[model samples]
Target: MNQEDQELQTEKKGNKVLVVGASGLIGISAIEAFLDAGWIVVGASRRKPILLSGRTLEHIKVDLLNKEDVFKTFQKYKDITHVVYAALYEKPNDLVAGWSDEEQIKINDQMLRNVIEPLIAVGAPLKHVSILQGTKAYGVHLHPINIPARESDPRDNHPNFYFDQQDYISEAGIKHGFHWTVLRPQLVTGKIAGALNILPAIGVYAAIRKEKGESFSFPGGPSFVWELADADLVGQVLLWSATSPNAADEIFNVTNGDVFEWRSVWPALAKTLDVQTGVDHSFSMAAYIEENKDVWAKVVEKYGLLNHDLNAFIGQGHAHADFAFAYGAPQGPVAFVSTIKLRQAGFFKVIDTRDALTEALQSFIDRKLLPPSIA
Candidate 1:
């Protein structure tokens, strides 16, 4: 047999894994990677299974919000050895002020009780549990002390669902007897088959503007810094965390190991989409969306898309916009460990940020998640 065939045969010899939120961007990649490594994977999603190749995969419809459903599913796979938790409620635009504090707490608190707590209680022979988290846990609006925010940075004083969920996992994991690892990644992007990304939204907007022969502008100032990480790299980290002895009961910050000013990334994106960049106008996403309410409406109406409440979307969008442009000006290069810790533990894979972005954009085109005009 050829070397390629021999390598594939060797990889088909690993362990069994159970992946929650298998339908999400990161989860799908994790499932694929684990399967490629020769692990028997059982994926649970609220929807149908994602088609995968090369390994045995079983998909089950699971409602993580329902305790009984979660329990029943785990009971069937009680013998499974590893668990990856990637399921999460999409952060609502109104998460900041629209909902009552009590309401927000209740929804997030119950998710922990119904899902994570049960896994802990069952004490399934899980050698490790890797929980997916984001940079938002550090605080959405507050300026982080450094550009590459470290895992040790103090969390924002503001309370939110992510903080609550992190607390729940920390508390529950300690009592439940499994080694737990948390991975906090910043803005993950990659070749997702049926996923949407903030970058693509920009691409689509730029594409439409180009098709209509209109100019494009960058909203928010150009000074903000946004850190981007590849979803495939994040998946690598997840698998590494699951098996690495150093990662047990610890949290790690995952990023692309570099920070980019939005000005640079935005224009690069515009160039990739063949759209005109730098139209000499600037506004925060909030102000732009508000001022151009009619324009956004026209775009939505022309495309026959669902009308997203501009005011609300803009509120969250502006926070991201502000961070993208202004975050690192005050903070010197945010000194977070990119794969430093993981590498020390012998997991040394690295992802090229530009290539990751290009591959992701192409995947969006191939899957029709975004239009060809955008490419």
Candidate 2:
């Protein structure tokens, strides 16, 4: 067996975990990873997740914003030993604009506190807590980030819940004698529909283009290097952080260990979806996806795919895609972050961006969540 496999084999099993935001990409990936590793998993979210690979994840419906509800719900799970806080709240209608909103910051901070404080109060044997942050923490949204943003870089003073939650967790860790790891990944890709992961939105866009008998063109503005984090890889890191000494109380920036320019990677994406790639055809993916819902429905019906209504299936993904693709911008931002710390810390996992995107897109097609590419 490989060293990592051996390590997983030796690790203790049957530790119960509470995965908040069970319906999201990272949460679903983490749940699957934990279950496969023999961890007793319970998921928390307002919406129960569909059965994962036929494994029925024990789920609890609770709103993280409702403090009393969160406390009441969590108090019952006294045996919970680990927490993966992957829940996120994005403004539904005005997704990007709300990122810097004070109310957004407050709500996110409270959500983290509501979940963790209650678990601590109920005296759950919380060994470790892992929460997520993204490129936004480095103020990438407002301005250019350091070429390769490092975790040790000075905080980009911003109106972000990441800071508030980090401060809260750091203090809590010291006070309660627990370990916490913060992961900041760039462009997380996964198969979950209606989550921030951009793969599904891309799938829908491809399906729509193929259905219209149009070439799969690069719809963004300019070429720029970008990084990606596979949801499964993020899950593995979460598992690593749960017990690895290197991960204890550490903040790590993670990616697929390589970079790709959208224009360069376009062919691979097109090949995976069996579509023909065209030259740069810059347009708003956010606007296009929003405008093509009826077309998506027809594609779904024609291909005998699942009924993933555009808005529900795409979530804020179209908007996130625009952000990732740098649509409507003069040039794409060079948003690369340092994963050296992550590697030096002993988690030596990596996946190519092309393969990562291929695997993610194929997953939806295999599940029939998205239509197969046009012949």
lDDT of model 1, residue 13: 44
Give the CA lDDT, 0 to 100, for residue 190 in model 2.
Answer: 77
Off by over 4 Å in 2: 1-14
**TM-scores, each model vs. reference:** 0.77, 0.95
Clashing pairs in 1: 146-334, 147-334, 148-334, 223-325, 224-324, 224-325, 224-326, 225-324
Minimum summed lDDT over a 10-residue window in model 2 is located at: 6-15
Model 2, position 122: C-alpha lDDT score: 81
Worst 10 residues of 1 by lDDT: 306-315
lDDT of 2 by residue, 74-159 (tens): 88888988899999888777777899988988999999999998888988888889999988999998998898899999999888
lDDT (Cα, tens digit) per residue for candidate 1, span 1-375: 899768556534455678887877788888887776667888888875554343446887888778788887767666667778777654555433532266765665676556555555665666777887666666544444454456777776765666666677677667766677888887776654323234544545554555566776765433544567787788778777777678888878787766666566656566565677765455444344445556656555555543245432222434344344442345322424355665566666766676677666665555544445333
* Candidate No. with top TM-score: 2
